[model samples]
Target chain A: MSSAAQGLRRTGSARRQPARPAWRERPKPATQAAKAVALAAVVLLVTVPFLIIVSTSFASNAEVVANGGWVLWPQHPTLNAYRELFDGGIVTHALWVSAGVTVIGTAASLACTIGLAYALSRRDVFGGKPILLLILFTFLFPPGMIPGFLLIKGLHLLNSYGSLVAPVLVNVFNLVVLRGFFQSVPEELYEAARLDGAGEWLILRRIVLPLSKAALAVVGLFYAVSYWNAWFYASIYLDSDHWPLQQVLRTYVVGGSQLADSAAGDASAVAAPQTIQMAVLVVATVPILLVYPFLQKYFTKGVLTGAVKS
Target chain B: MAIAERDATGRTGAAGASGADRRAGRKGRGTRLTRLRRDWVLLALMAPGVAYFLVFHYGALAGNVIAFKDYVPFDGLWASQWVGLDNFQKMFGDPDFWSAVLNTVWIALLQLVFFFPVPIALAMLLHSLTRDSVRKFVQSVAYLPHFLSWVIVVAVFQQVLGETGLLNNVLGDAHLHTVDVIGNPGAFKPLVIAEVIWKDCGWGTIIFLAALTQVDEQQYEAAAIDGAGPWRRFWHITLPSVRPIIVLLLIMRLGDILSVGFEQMLLQRASVGPDAAEVIDTFVYYKGLVGGDYGYAAAAGLFKGVVGAALVFAANKVAHRLGEQGVYR
Candidate 1:
């Protein structure tokens, strides 16, 4: 989000068009106010609910119950819900599972995508055309859900972390984006690298990867986000003990399962189910929030580079 | 956030760079062996991704043959008994299947009517803002929800609109009639659409905003010079500029219309009952996975896949007729 703003600041001075050009007149005060109100409504529609979720997650149990399950402003904010969640129970176990999947899955996905994208971007590699065509064909007509589930079963991937990552190891969209970004590197650079005795792998590591940091970051973030957010396959393939955070949270929060056993002890140890649910929601949300600012700066540059150049 | 464009032909990506050189550089049959030997490293680099597609995509695709089989737990995919269209006959005659189809089509049409044009309008609104900071802030906030999982989004909505949720609480205080939304059958379609709007409308604007930026300032200036008002200027310049992309997206949406949010519906299906919320994807899940009717469910899924692929092919043909790039050439 801030990435676009940073792009604006970086290019604002060099921008050719003025805010109000000579041929255009400024709008009336009423119009400006209406526009402001509209923009504010858009922002509020997004933010207010999020603010309430975060606030209710920290509110004391009594206050949350009194507020009828959604606390706007927590007068007595407490960390008891989060405390109970992390008391070595299901939420804690699932959190580690999600983290483990995210780290391993993102790394594997990025590595495979980089290799394939780089190979496809180059000219006249043997079998590259056929391979690229075959992959792109699958994008048009994806494999069906039942067959996909059956495959996982046949492969004995049921209830394993491998089921989460192996089946979706390389996303075609990310591959195409990286491929487009790689192709944008001038051929002259490749020639110069070759003259200096650089092999393909070395060229990739030293030249292509360094130059394509923006795109790489964007793709990496995408892989990470998808892995973290994934639960559908987890629901189908994994047992409850092996489930990821999102899947477990789905049962407790959306499925409205009992919260007393979600943690280690009796009912008194946990906060209100409402607050515990909100806490789980916040835990599921925080990683994305933590990671967004760093890579979001590349959104415009990375996306446009692929789209325009390809 | 992806834009409207799809790279259907990888050849076009390389077309601009090494079109002639590739033909000349790696010529006839003699050097083909040499070229293969030389390019082994590149092929080695591609092995993991290539193997992934082979095993997961095509492997699963081949597994679709079960649609014609009576699947047994002990008997594998190839070993299953060939029932030969029996599953399809059963699926076609099922009233539940037709009802699911109806629900899918009705929900997709609602999305087309409500969820389609939001981003375009939001993009235009964001574009018209002269204050760069405000525009950036709004874009950032609006796009935040798209990152959330369906589980979380559904939970948030339930928290806001469930029987004991915040909306009812506020209404109770104000002594007004409270609207029941989350699990209500009549409100399901609108609730789903609203969830979609909250999550994706902001992210969808990125493509249109990119298109809006590409509109030459001179065109807007020229329209203003011609004494056109803001609305007329938008009609003449802005709308025309984004129309191509809008058409491209609509065609693409048509291709994907049947597949609604499966996990989303699955999460809330028990609360509202299948009559109100069952679509093809969730129906496949419940029938095949939960209910243990593998062959019949695979048939339903195969039917959906074939129709969806046909729609894409037809949509692409229409795109070519319109002289625009579709999902493929």
Candidate 2:
């Protein structure tokens, strides 16, 4: 088709035009150096604290104390702090709680979001526009903290794990993102599926979901991260026994409380509090660090599609 | 057609009934039944999401009624005595409430003035990178902090800038005066603003970088060919292209100005004390949850919610007047 030829010609012209355009000329040496220095500063500002935290976590107790509570690099790397953290105590329990919440919540959230988004993505679906607006309106005027608290209390969900997941089951933003992605599917494909006598559910199961794996992964990661990072709800709703890791982290680390209290035993047997704190920080942060790179490339496209379309 | 005609005419005439008309009528009813059957699955699919909104959002919205009542835990929400704005009257007269409002507005303004432009500048910096690989590397490193929980972020700040933290340690080693950045009430606002900038500026740049990409390469080339310098081209072409996005974000920021970071302040509030750190949200948490003055706190919260919603509407109106797309049409 002529359209294919035009696309080829466009690519050909794009390739040719980039060959030394005036705007593409290299900047002056001074300007280049300044840019490099500015960028290096930005990179350093972000990376140094992480480096320090990792180093301190690995540092020996004596070295950490001698270095005045932080180590740039470990003199003697040890797993003593991490070992203490997982020795079946508060941190251990909280880690399990956080992991369970994240996995189950992400699955549940993604399922609900996909179901709703897919239904809404179809043109002329009954009451779809009203439902979409109803959802979007919540974003503009959120129920404040007090009322939200009261509702949770009234539901008798206080001091319960359900408080964490039930109150924030589906993020409207994620739903909107998935809806936009679903809407971008080609109409002709739907017609073809319909011609084959496939129902909406069959088409969704076979075609739409398979095609939206990237978006699903991205939204799932977002949900997972939110559930993992949530501490405020846990702080308010759950008692100390049921607190998740971030809430534990908030209480002992950021709140500057005694580690012995949170660890639920005598303080004499444990390693340095600084080391344990850094280890806890490392434990809290490591999962996101591990998963970030693989999903990093999807961030722009995934977020922008939602941002633009919505 | 004959059966339809008979039905429409309200005549009982089986002899005039045609096969096609009977079939058409039956087919119409069949299609309706089929459509209803098909829609049921979609409805079933949408049920959970709709129920979540209804129970969590709308249901919580209904609970705002407790603001006008003496909310007793034993009596529950409905059985509580109605005091009809006594809670609001108490909140309006409370000096502590005013102080919290002052702190919230002050911090919000500080963030607006200082923290708002960071992402734009960072985006411009990244956008100007001629090498794609370098841009990618820098971007990956930059956005890492945004994903961190405020707990972790506050902890990191404590470790690096606390009284005995890295900076103080380094200063002590260098025979310099050590500074107390964390836990210093005087430094809390700036410190919080700095934390906000460090955590979010890079992630914030995503939209602006996206906006930057939409700037026309042809126009830049044209400007360059006409001897327009880099700065001039950027000012003329790039800034204008991203201005609408900047405006849109500004409106959103204004709407959210009342919040000014609840979790961030909450984490640090006890250290600095409420005088320097009590934003509206933290104040609400302390008074309602900790102090158990539920009715008064709920009234304050309702006040915030209504003001926030109004601000959003007003900001959107302003945005529309300025010839930009607001959050909604």
Candidate 3:
């Protein structure tokens, strides 16, 4: 009787608690304050360089030079660096190439990966186990640089846009993740479709694709980012004019080419290398920043579930 | 029990409906043909995928045999002269190659030690937060760096620490002596490690976060009721829950000790000089691709691959012995 009464008392006391308490049982205001401070510190450490660049990109040459190469906030922010970059046509052209590669590459990758992942997901599919082993074996022993490069060259793919798309169309890791996700779909769904007289294509298009949206999105994002950031292959397979924005950024930032010759600008503004580099950095990062928030939720679940494999 | 019986009935019914499928199995030779015939649609669906592997993956694997020969583009892979272990010997004798191997191992070890724990710590902090909104906000902010390119990452580091960059500028403003951080060999290792942590530490938290979610809330409640302190409860409950994940990640990381991030190292190699930054991947790129010493680079590549596979096999064996579920069967 006392135990029942105690249970009732505990339930009553729990109901009395507020919907959302400002603080929990520990009451570590000092600790939370310290954590908040520490988190802010970490964020600042990661973000300050970014801030400096964006601020410096707009700063006047005199201010930047006088400030000994950086301005925390532009004394007078200007779009002169951007104007020069756009006028040069190189940055504009490279931007288009990068966007094209990302779009085409992502589309091709998604289609092939989905097709493959879907086929492999079905346990009763002919030769599925061996095919999966074949794919997984590549992850274990990746084809070396010389061999991979030679294969591309042998196919007469050098200097062709197809080189970028064809060689890396389907990442095995992405494929495996997608396959795992596809496999997780209830067998009853496939059976239901089969009973409804749906063929493999109809079932894939109607049933599988809808269920695998999160996996597809995550895989698509990985492909797109990889294509955007890829410069090594472009360096090997592409001519100088055909290089992507990353390669262009690499040339400017790492190679230390002045933005002056590209445009006959006020040497002072162009002379501030800090802002110019930051402008490039911002350009490189803008695509990811724009797309990341929308796909944030998929990342938490989609990534790890896919990553459960070795 | 009823469901199992019903499933068996359904299976038998399905088998009865597909008479030819069952009948063909009675004739052993015909069963193979029937199985192939039945899966024709699946094969059609899988054609492009198989073609991809054959062309890109297996095709590339076949090309690795050139490591045994003196490869010439004009003469081609098959036509090249056979020079068996000479390439491997050259790679072994090369001091530069040895140093690259050393640098890769050292950097990987540092990352395993320093960068590995930060994500777990961050995840714990996020887990402990009372407000869900705050935790989500912190995670969103932390994950931003992971998506940024290594070029941008390197550029960010350079703009902040390069000669006439932000750090020196700040120091100058304060009337303090400037420090040369960027392009300094002494600081290069720390710079690479820091960049890696900034870029990937948050991404690493995803697995840990997933692992943490499976922990039962009732355990925490019981611990609290039992008057166990937060620290004690954390040690007893939370750590044990996530221990397998930690062990699994460590084993996987150990297997990949030779492959530090390729693009990151490649980008910074020129700045820091090859001594500090030349890892196995970059060394292969320079020697095989740029210098056209295909055999030597291929030999080195094969060597790394062999070691990696061996390590994975060993790690799996060890995990099984320890009574833990490993990466593979």
Predicted chain A of model 3: TM-score relative to the true chain A? 0.86
Docking class of 1: medium
Model 2 CA lDDT for position B15: 18
User: Native-contact fraction for each model?
Assistant: 0.58, 0.53, 0.50
Could you tell me which 10 consecutive residues in candidate 3 chain B have the lowest summed lDDT?
Answer: B1-10
Question: Model 2: runs farther than 4 Å from truth?
Answer: A1-21, A24-26, A261-270, A302-309, B1-35
Please tell me what DockQ candidate 1 reaches: 0.54
- Candidate 2 per-residue lDDT over residues B1-329, each given as its tens digit: 11112222232122124322432212233454575675777888999999999999999988889999999988988999999989999998989999999999999999989999999999998877765557778888998998999999999999999988999999999999999899999999889999999899989987777666655578888888998888899899988877877887888888988898899999999999999999999989999999998888888888998999899899989988988776676
Cα lDDT computed for each candidate against the true fold = 0.83, 0.82, 0.77
Clashes of each: 0, 1, 0
Per-residue accuracy of model 2 over A1-310 as CA lDDT, tens digit each: 2221222223233433423465556778998899899999989989999999999988888998888999998978998888888878899999999999999998999999999999987655666779998998888878888899988987889998889999899998888778767866656567677778888899899999999887888888999999999999999999999989999999989988857844733352447888888989999999899878755757765243233424
Off by over 4 Å in 1: A1-13, A16-18, A262-270, A302-305, A308-310, B1-30
Query: What's the CA RMSD of model 1 in angstroms?
Result: 2.8
Colliding pairs, model 2 = B1-B21
Candidate 2, residue A7: CA error in Å?
A: 18
Instruction: Please state the error at residue A104 of candidate 3 in Å.
Output: 0.4
lDDT of 1 by residue, A74-190 (tens): 998899888888888888899999999999999999999999999998767888888999998887778898899999999999999999999899998889888887877766677
True contacts kept of 2: 0.53
Judged by lDDT, which candidate is best?
1
Model 1, range B167-193, lDDT digits (tens) per residue? 898999999999999889889989999
Clashes of 2: 1
